[model samples]
Target: MTTHSLIVTGLAAGYGDSDILHDLDLTVPAGKITAIVGANACGKSTLLRAMSRLLKPRAGQVLLDGKSVHKTSPKELARTLGLLPQSPIAPEGITVADLVSRGRHPHQGLFGRWTREDDEAVRAALDVTKTGDIAERNVDELSGGQRQRVWIAMALAQETEVLLLDEPTTFLDINHQIEVLDLMTDLNQTRGTTIAMVLHDLNLAARYADYLIAMTAGRVHVSGSPETVLTEDNVRQVFGLESRVIADPTSGRPIMLPLGRHHVTQA
Candidate 1:
């Protein structure tokens, strides 16, 4: 890893009076993919926002490279950390290349002029995301999966060491979800990018993540390798759903099969 990235301690954040998160401590290993999973409203998105410096912590601190994130300049921070929220907006007429090029804003100078490095980064990001063929295409005209990939490409162009994503698989079908995760895995392996993503799909999380953090009601329920933390008992406790976790025949990692009421057999 080029840099030892984010360290968060006693981190608590939320909007207005209601406290969505209690004290939290987490250390993200550089260059590894960490997946955060939980039921809805478990502070998954808020945790990502806090680490990315979008949401202010009420009690504890989020440190990026040993420095307080609150003290870090936005441009400098942007250079080190990139975040992709669930749904990012592009201007109506924005081209894929134009939007991806905007990731270089952090690298710009006083006049914010574009540089060769910026152009190269944009092109490289497009190429890596496989959107180079559609570089001139309007972003609004793309499919949900393609649009998501474009947003990811824009984040990639920033060339940050640590990338955070919230619900990266929300709108996609099963195949595209796998596609995005595969792309992210490739990026992590190829560039040594440290990644932390919040995922709603437990199965996908287990399949793709190097590490998993299971959260419940704003606190970490358990964290470790998927095989360690994603057992049937843990799933029942954290997600409040009965499930049977078995080894995936292909991968050997944990695989959750939820047991719904309708699926229960009569005695």
Candidate 2:
């Protein structure tokens, strides 16, 4: 149950010539779930990519336990950090078992010998994600929800202490979104895995995240507990939307209720 620290210092990353993330400083609390939320193109995903070393930072560095993540060896980093991208591709005709087993690659040596531990890891991941029933099924053939869960299983099988996900709830229905988020919470609780994800749904982000980061124009507007960060003014300024923040009766978490022209009652 050792949780490692992740820090970003003066990080600037983007596509080619354009910088999507400015000089940003962030510290991910160990063993907690942190969600990054903002309007589209606000650099939520870009920040995530930089943190995971998928995108190179132009100005600064991402530090995992005080060491530069980009300078770490690929297999060593993979063993310590797992990333689920916004869109993950499974090779055509690959079975769920095979794809999940691929997560054990980091643990394997140059000889690539598969061990009983590998089998157990894949099985545990599948069972936890409720994808064991489809273990033999082709990943491409499953429904969107099932596919997403299976992909999560693969990440889980990696057995990393830190996990990063980019919009893990993308294309999911409300129920499936909750399912995946709840699963993430379970991972945080049971395994003490440090989880950081980019989420578009403000309400869901507030509900599930222990810490919420609100980004605006490639910079972090504010970050703290959901109740503190989801204030009306911050929401409006970051999202450019008029909204009311309410306490979710179930979890007592902050929930954003957008105010539209038609939804407002004239006094």
What are the runs in model 2 whose C-alpha is more than 4 Å off? none
Clash count for each candidate, listed in order shown: 0, 0
- Model 1 regions lying over 4 Å from their true place: 264-267
Q: After superposition, how far is residue 209 of candidate 2 from its true place, in Å?
A: 0.5
Worst 10 residues of 1 by lDDT: 258-267
| lDDT by residue (tens digit), candidate 2, 95-128 | 9999999999999999989999999999889988
Full-model lDDT for every candidate = 0.90, 0.93
Candidate 1 C-alpha lDDT tens digits along 7-65: 88888889999778889888887889999999899999999998888998898999988
Q: Give candidate 2's error at residue 159 in angstroms.
A: 0.4
CA lDDT, candidate 1, residue 179 = 88
| Residue 144 in candidate 1, Cα distance off native in Å | 0.4
Evaluate model 2: give its TM-score. 0.98
- For all predicted structures, in order, the TM-scores are 0.97, 0.98
Best by TM-score: 2
